[model samples]
Target: MNIPGELYFTKEHEWVRIEGDTGIVGITDYAQHSLGDVTFVELPKIGADVKQFQSLATIESVKAASDIFSPVSGKVAEANKKIEDDPALVNRSCYSEGWIAKIKMCEPSEKNNLMDAAAYKKFVERLEH
Candidate 1:
């Protein structure tokens, strides 16, 4: 799994890359791998309000459909239209071009609830066993 050290992770397998008050969110590499080849991504509407740990988007793959939860509470600033047009981008490069949304954080401090790469790596290990 490509777990970038700078990003924060959630137990539900989403990642957040915070830049100032905006946070870029995506399903983790582990999540995309588990779901198999992605076929669709249902993006949240721009300007929509979302809460931490709540469902932010949905993804469908050949194997299953899964809800993507927000790693931090915020307003949906943007959704990656690339993934909408080519959901396979999720399987191709989940951490980069496949990112799902960008949120304008309501409270940056809520990021403290998330895990670092090391912690998330352990979390994924636990799930594998």
Candidate 2:
């Protein structure tokens, strides 16, 4: 619901914030709402390599567990350790502190394939109908 203007989105419901050759990834607000109250998360370790549209992490909520997809191909540079300690942060702050991983983007051009906020906004609108 709160799709920030600066981020890109994937059909899998992941959001990406790009900065230079790095990207911060996380599930969108719509994803957290659909999942209900989050209980746990399995984040990929640093140095892990991830491919576009592939599984990068897993999130468990009261409703269900889901695999979080990578919006771009990259190597994991860092993960939000705080979320492992308190998964609720995802429900509370999905855009900022709740970001799951920071990747050293392997192909910066891949971002062009991802949906911009406006496009993603339209995509979610289509889903609601």
Candidate 3:
């Protein structure tokens, strides 16, 4: 539920921090809270291609395993190796150190499909209602 104002969010609950053409992706804080303790992260390879809304990685928590979809189509340029070794980073710092992948976007305009913090907050609110 910690939807920072700087990031964009997908309906799938993925968050993206866009820095120029590169975007850092992660599950929202709300997602990790719902998932409970994270135990494992299956990351995409550095050079792998992932399309918008496609499954890019998987995370296993105490409750269940979940696929993390790409927020935008792009080539994965890097992954957070720390999460593989200490998945709790996701629980502790979902928006920063716990980021899953860095992508070099194939279509920057896909950002338009994402929701800003206020919009996403309302979206989550609607889901609760």
Candidate 4:
């Protein structure tokens, strides 16, 4: 339920912390909570091309496995290797250390397609009910 004010959110429950031409991406707090303890994270490879709303990676939790979609078109810049050994980092620190990938956005304007903190908080609240 922790919806940060600065990052953008997707309907599928991914978030991107926009940083200049780079975007740091991860599953939302709500998503990790819904998925339960994450057991695996299939990170996208560095240098791979990805499109907004496309499958960026996959995550497996005790409850179920789910796709992590990209929030913008980009080339993968870095994948968090720490999660490979301890996926629970996602459960422990999803907004910081547990971030899934860093992307070099090909189209920054695509961010407008995503929701801001206010909208996404409302969106998640609706889902909760």
Please identify model 4 stretches exceeding 4 Å from their true place.
Answer: none
TM-score of 2: 0.98
* Residue-by-residue lDDT tens digits, candidate 2, 61-92: 98788999999999999999999999999999
lDDT of 1: 0.94
**What TM-score would every model get versus the actual structure?**
0.97, 0.98, 0.97, 0.98
Q: Model 4 Cα RMSD, Å? A: 0.6
Minimum summed lDDT over a 10-residue window in model 3 is located at 27-36
| List of clashing residue pairs for candidate 1 | none
> What is residue 9's positional error in candidate 2, in angstroms?
0.4
Model 2 residue runs over 4 Å out of place are: none
- lDDT agreement with native, every candidate: 0.94, 0.94, 0.95, 0.95
lDDT, model 2: 0.94
Task: Give candidate 3 regions above 4 Å deviation.
Answer: none
